[model samples]
Target: MIGMAMRGEADIAIGPITRTAARLNVVDFLTPFQEEGIGFVMKKIDSPLLEQMFHVFRPISLVCWVAVVVSTVLTGIILTILAKLSPSAEHKEASLSRNLWIALSSILGQEDCPRPTFHQGYIILGFWWIFITLIMALYASSLAAFLTVPLPNAPLRNLEELASQTHYKPLVTQGTNLFHLFKSAKGGLHKRIWEMMSDMPKITVMDEAFSLVETGKYAFISDSSELRFELRNKCDELEIAQDSFLLTQLSFVVQKNFPFKDAFDHQ
Candidate 1:
């Protein structure tokens, strides 16, 4: 409609179009009738506590978890190789799988692992014991702290938090102003959000965005007023994020330098 208006095919483009500096270059906007901002809409969490039960692994970060696993495997391989080379009569031959199991069990504080007889074996076992004990202590303390403390079940508060988590796939309609905002973004939260949405099929309609949000695994970003009006019937199931972004005025688009612009502004 904006192109049509610019080509002299239409005098004006109607509806709740956003007024932007870029759009003003090719067309003119009427006196903005309304002001609004972008918002995120998602299903409300009904049982935050139950949702948290599955997040037991949150006590350790992904990097730390990967480091622990890699170190444990490397320790097991070293122990197995040392066992093969040790000439002591007391050093029993063990398979790589057995040593791996021993390494895993020892980290868990199990008592069945046999004591090593050779000096190198003893040294390796000693260091491994100390390392595993420290890791266990840290994990135990953190888990205990998490269990005993009361934490707020805060809803998705802002874009930074939303972009950082994998729980919800944030979505925006294709070709809309909000979509273009992220698509053209070079860095930071907007870029992150665009990358996330790129994985799913392009969403073309607002209804599809609402359907995806209903499943609780996706969030839709759109005009706050539109979301409120559309989701009015499903207040209990869906909610808009408390915060908004990309605040702008909404107005109708008219041909560039339309003669009636002054008269339209008067009303």
Candidate 2:
């Protein structure tokens, strides 16, 4: 379209062509109709059944659980030793199994759990109760969060995340402004991404790229609004990632000396 307009085959080249410095030298752009930035579309993935089943334990780590178990056993052992060392005859007949049962029941908030027999035992039990209460409170809060928070639509939320991952290939429409943006990148994330996609197959059409995205293998980058418009009907299977970059105005192209520039800009 740009070439046609430049050659006088068309008076105006229309659509959401990005206004860039290089293009400006060859053709003039009407006042931008819209301003948008780059974004990506990818397929939505559901949490696996295995992940859903084990979500109950997501609140706490394995190491923390192990530590809790070790603490409970140690508390039980200390309580049994204290009972045997007590001066009172009534408190002297302590067993490890009984102490362990008491510790477990107390930690579980059991009302009928046996109490410590001596002063030292009571002090230790009090501290243990405090520790167990804290652990339980933390676990409850974390479990609530795990249950209520929805999973992300896609794992790659933004450009940085997409750049960091290796499994998903980034794609752009060939010969587009976005394509040029990466091709001309000299340094930073854009340059890195361009390098990464150097050997990957090129995508020439948005629909073709989106189809690949649906397979969970490719990410298509384009103007944010355009990506949204294209995915409006397919939202159940595809979604725009939470990224906006390469900000630019979109306008129609006209010949460099086109006479009606003001008339078009006003609309």
Candidate 3:
């Protein structure tokens, strides 16, 4: 790590470092830029309503809805025809038909008359059917749009990475050294990659130095700091590499309150 630092090629790095070894010989690790806190947060439990909605026979609910829609459409058509053809005389016809049956009691005791028109009833029912159908369509379209949009996973995997790009992807907790480190060093930082890191395993930023080594299958370490503001929730997940780096000091990039001529000063 010290040999690489001498060349000044590693533009960006975030990790723990003391003024020792090859770094002390020539390269500058700066003051501690950030400290790392590490731990794992398990996945959230699924909602009960959502879980039950996907259970077997759920399609039955959809089928019932479709059936109701079909029935309403048919009823609307029937009502439309009835409303266009019904007459005010239909009520009188029904009354006369009943009286005729009474007069024919000695004979067949029945009367012939057209059925009463239900035009007004049909018109009202049809209007309601159209309203319900429109609502259903709007709901379906909204659901489709929600399903189509893509949601991004959190960036920045662990504290070391958090130390470097933490300004962009790191999450911090109150009173954490990592939080203070980021607060100070965020103004200006450097970066670089190494050949050894290419084969390093992946690690989640659970705590200090978990990402220092690598597993056969994975090659990243994860970390986060200053969680309350926004980053902790955003960079909830991340992957980090196992390459060790020269830790830089957390220096403040004073923009508004630049006491010195340079923005990068001891914050």
Candidate 4:
């Protein structure tokens, strides 16, 4: 499933039809240069799932309570443990007298002692925890990048030009299923100079939306509708047609033999 391209088991498709993404393999899909909006549809029903998840965040405030409890317990524990930390020799050399000396030192005298080695061990453990977390985070990030397919180049003009160009490479999204109209635009060429000209070279493909523009030097094309909407939202220099045949649309259709088109219609 992954790396089918590396394995050399991929298939390329050419059609005068709408192309779906070839998500599983590497190849060319000669698809119609049509524009369409995509959407997600689901049954409508009210449910408590969204609300229940919101309540899960309520316990996040417990971090403050945990901090207070841990700090207070740590303060008391450290003070009690300070007695044992005085010196091992103090236990055999003297008993409560050393305690009295410590109390006196705290009140008016002074006590000199080396730092605790356990604190150093705690610092070392913290660093070890941070290092493991960083490694795991880096591994997950790398895996995500590895699994992702790069965006395919959009052929601003037509399909064949985008697929064949090397120096003027066009980037397309991964698995761009193109149609047959792009691969076979030559059958009726004498009267269609504009369509023929669109098949010219130097149209390197890229998937980024903003890569095409600057009308004089660069020409961008998509489904006429998409081009219209994109220019409306994008820069002023991008132009569209007033009376061009390049305008198009996409419709859902079933095969002539597929009787389910009538029997299994959308509600």
Candidate 5:
């Protein structure tokens, strides 16, 4: 369409024509009718509640769990030894079962356990309390963050992430403006992403590209507007990435010397 306008073979080229630096040199564009950006379309993420529930324990390492258990048992033993060495009969006769119960209760957040009677017992309990406090604090903060945030199926939120992953094929139409934009991108993240896309197989049709994305093995990089429109009516399984890059203005294209260019711009 842009070629037709540039060659003066067509009076105007409408539809979703992107106004790019390359196109601007040959053809004049009217005021942008729609603002759009390039983004990825992929299957919607569905993280199971059961999986999330299991993730609660992920913050604490297996080693940490083992350490906590060993510490609890050792603290109980220390309390029992302290009680045996105490001058008071009640402290001297403290049973191992009672000492272990108190240690377990304190670690589990239960405050019903009796206070340590001896100074040595108090010191052991104080150290155990500090350990429990730190462990609980870390677990609570990690679990809260995991449960409150929505987990995405694909972790590719931006072009950099998309380029980094090897699981999904990130694609663009071979001869479209988007392909050219990426191809001509000078250096930096855009250039790296362009290389990644170039390595992957290209799909010629938009529908075909979207269909592949719906299967969850591919991510289609294209116009946000078209992707949203198709997602609303055709592909419920598909979702667009939240972050968009390479914003392009959609406008009508006309010959460089077209007489009514200003008129079109005014409207």
Candidate 6:
């Protein structure tokens, strides 16, 4: 459409055609009717079922879990060994099973287990309590964050992030101004993304690009209004990014010295 207007083959082209400095050389655009920016259309991200189920345990590292288990066993063994060495009948009655129960219960924040009676038992139990207190505090502090925080499906929020990721394929219409916008952009995120897209297959149609976006692997960069319209009417799974890199004012394209330029601008 822009080509037709530029070549003077069409008197006027009515649509959301961006008016850039380069285009102004060949064609005149009426006062902008719509203002928008170039943004990506992506698929809505869904949290995984497995992640949701295990969210409670995600706060602590795997090494921490192993450490906790090892500490529990060691504390129980220490208690049992100390009890055997004690001469008192009450201390000697602390069997391996009883010591293990005490250790497990203390670690689990339970108070039902009997307290250690011997002096050595007291020292070992005191150290075990300190360790348990620290571990409990760490787990409690991180647990709330893991359980309540919502993880976004697409972690890429801006062009730089989108460009950095290989899993996300950002696309643009083959012949549109957006294609040229990136193609001519110099030495920045725009050029980087343009180079990335250059190696991949070209997307000629918005609908085709949108279909790929529905799969959640591809991102389509295009006019915000058009993308939003399609998102509302066709694909519910698609979403628009909050940040737009290229701001453009859209107007009807008319050939230079066209008779209706004045009338169109006045209206």
Candidates' lDDT values, in order? Answer: 0.83, 0.86, 0.37, 0.36, 0.81, 0.82
Query: Taking the tens digit of each residue's C-alpha lDDT, what string does model 1 give over 133-204?
Result: 888888889889887895533368778888999999988888887878888999988999989987865789
- Kindly list the per-residue Cα lDDT of model 6 for residues 184-211, writing each as its tens digit: 9888888899888866567787788987
Clashing pairs in 2: none
Residues 1-267 of candidate 2: C-alpha lDDT, one tens digit per residue: 989999889999989999989999999999887888888988787779998798787799999899999999999999888888888615433888888987898778999877876788889889999999999999999888887996667778889988999878898888988788889999999988898788767778877788888888888888899888988799888878876887889999999899998888887
Please give, for residues 56-131, the per-residue lDDT of candidate 5 as tens digits. 6777788988998998888888888778888763743377888888889987778777778778788888988998
* Superior candidate under TM-score, 1 versus 4: 1
Off by over 4 Å in 1: 48-154
Best prediction by lDDT: 2
Collision pairs in model 1: none
lDDT of 4: 0.36
Which residues of candidate 4, in runs, are more than 4 Å off?
1-179, 187-210, 214-216, 246-249, 253-259, 263-267
TM-score of 3: 0.29
- Per residue, candidate 3 scores C-alpha lDDT tens digits across 52-141 of 576433323676567655655554454444444566434443343332332222122123522234656435544654655564565567
Cα displacement (angstroms), candidate 2, residue 254, comes to: 2.7
For model 6, which pairs clash?
none
lDDT of 1: 0.83
Better of 4 and 5 by TM-score: 5
CA shift of 250, model 2, Å: 1.1
